[model samples]
Target: MKARILFVCLGNICRSPMAEAVMRHQVEQAGLNDRIEIDSAGTGDWHLGHPPHEGTRKLLDEHQISYQGMKARLVAESDFETFDYIVCMDTKNLRDVRELLKNAGTLESRAKVFTFMELLPDKGIADVPDPYYDGNFPFVYELVNSGCRELLKRVQADLKLA
Candidate 1:
């Protein structure tokens, strides 16, 4: 089975979608597109059906990373069963996702939910800041890129794709 990954944040328009695009790019580059699946969602429903934030779009365009056909979506309880990894952009997102799973009575899911920063503990950063407000897409892109690279390695090892 493909190793499914879900990137999450407060609003799908920013960090999560950026991470999704970056991870997708890396996966395709590694030739693991066939072995892995990637997607993104938000803990909040505010941006449902909306495309990524303008900053995200512009930065992605600058990097030549395609965010094609990507839309903001809310995290669903079923995601617990569907994705092998549910990566959050920050601590609050992580808490919200776990709380959602708990409230849904999905105490035990195959998905391992965690903050994106957990993949790069030495970075001394706990959150992938929201560029929607600060307009720091470039910095967020750097964090997302680094995290996605590490995440790909973890997924490869976990799924035995490496």
Candidate 2:
């Protein structure tokens, strides 16, 4: 069966959506699109039905990455059971997801959750910083892009789907 992955963030407008797009591109480039299902959601419903943040869309466009046909969705109760992996962008998101899945019962066992950067050798720096509150769009883009590349490698290695 195809492995299902979900990326989570505060509002699904910046970090999580960016990671989702980056990972989708990587998986398709590796010709594993059929073997992997990628999606993104927010811990809160603040951005529901909203498009990704403009800066994020622009960054992806600058990289020739298409993030069209995507919409923000809330992380549903069923997501705990549906996704094989629930990757959060930051520690706050991790806590939020943990709370959401706290009473999900056995779904907890099958749900593998972590910050996207946790797959890297660096442990403490895994949380993707929220750039919406700052003017450092370029730096945030670079950090997220680099982390996404590392995350792709880990995903490939872990699933042996490389």
Candidate 3:
């Protein structure tokens, strides 16, 4: 059975989408794409149906990461039940996701939720800083790339992928 991962954040504009795309790429490169399903969403519905933030799209373009055909979606209540792991961008997102899952009854035992940063303590970066409101796209790009790389390592280790 494939392990499903859902990335979450306040808005689906910046951090979450970036992490989603990068992690998807890493999983594909590692040949785990067939056994792992990756997707992303937001705690709120603010950007639902929208493409990722322009800066985010641009960064992906620069990296030659194919993020086309992706649309932002609100994290549904069923997501907690559907996903094997729910990864949030930061502590605030983690708290909100926890609250959401707690209220969703069946999700109470269906998912393991965590902040993406928690998987990579050795990097010393606690979170992927949101750069949507700010003009610094490069910083957000680098943060997501770093986090995704570390996350790929952890996921591979967890799955014991050779």
Candidate 4:
């Protein structure tokens, strides 16, 4: 079965979407695209239906990473049941997701929700900050790039990928 991953952020226009695209790229390059699914969402509905932020699009463009077909959407309760991992961009997002799960009464779901930075080697780095406000897309991109790489490595080992 394909392992599903869902990236979550406050608006889904910056951090989460960037992580989704970067992680997808890493999975595809590793030839594990068929074994893994990538997706993203937001905790709030403010940006629902909106495309990723211009900053995110531009940064991904520079890296030749495609964020096409990505649109902001609020996280549904089903996400906790559907995705293998529901990774958040920051502490607020993580707390929001946990609350959502609690509200859904499925807090014991199979999906694991945590910060995207949790996969990073440095335990001190706790978040992939939202770049929508300060336009710090480059910094977010660098962090997501490494985080996704490490996430891929973890998935590779977990799935016994060749």
Q: What lDDT does each candidate get?
A: 0.93, 0.82, 0.82, 0.87
As a TM-score, model 4 comes out at 0.95
* Position 7, candidate 2: lDDT: 92
Give per-residue CA lDDT, model 4, range 55-91, as digits (tens). 9999999989998899999999999889988889988
The TM-score of candidate 3 is 0.90
Model 1 lDDT-worst window of ten? 105-114
* lDDT of residue 76 for candidate 2: 84
Per-candidate Cα RMSD to the true structure, in Å, reads 0.8, 1.9, 1.7, 1.2
User: Compared with the true structure, what per-residue lDDT tens digits does model 3 show for residues 1-162?
Assistant: 567889998888888888889888888888888888889999888888899899989888989887877889988897877888888988989888888777876447466788887866876877667887776879877767777777777666677764
What would the per-residue lDDT of candidate 1 be over residues 48-138, giving only the tens digit for each residue? 9999999999999999999999999999988999999999999999989989999998687899889999998998989888888888999
lDDT of 2 by residue, 1-162 (tens): 678889999999988888888888878888888877889999888889999999999898988887998899999878887888888888899888888787555436376888776765454575677877885667667766777777677667778866
Error of 2 at 113 (Å): 0.4
Off by over 4 Å in 1: none
Best by lDDT: 1
Q: Give the poorly placed runs of model 3, Cα more than 4 Å off.
A: 123-125
Off by over 4 Å in 4: 121-123
Residue 43 miss distance in model 4 (angstroms): 0.2
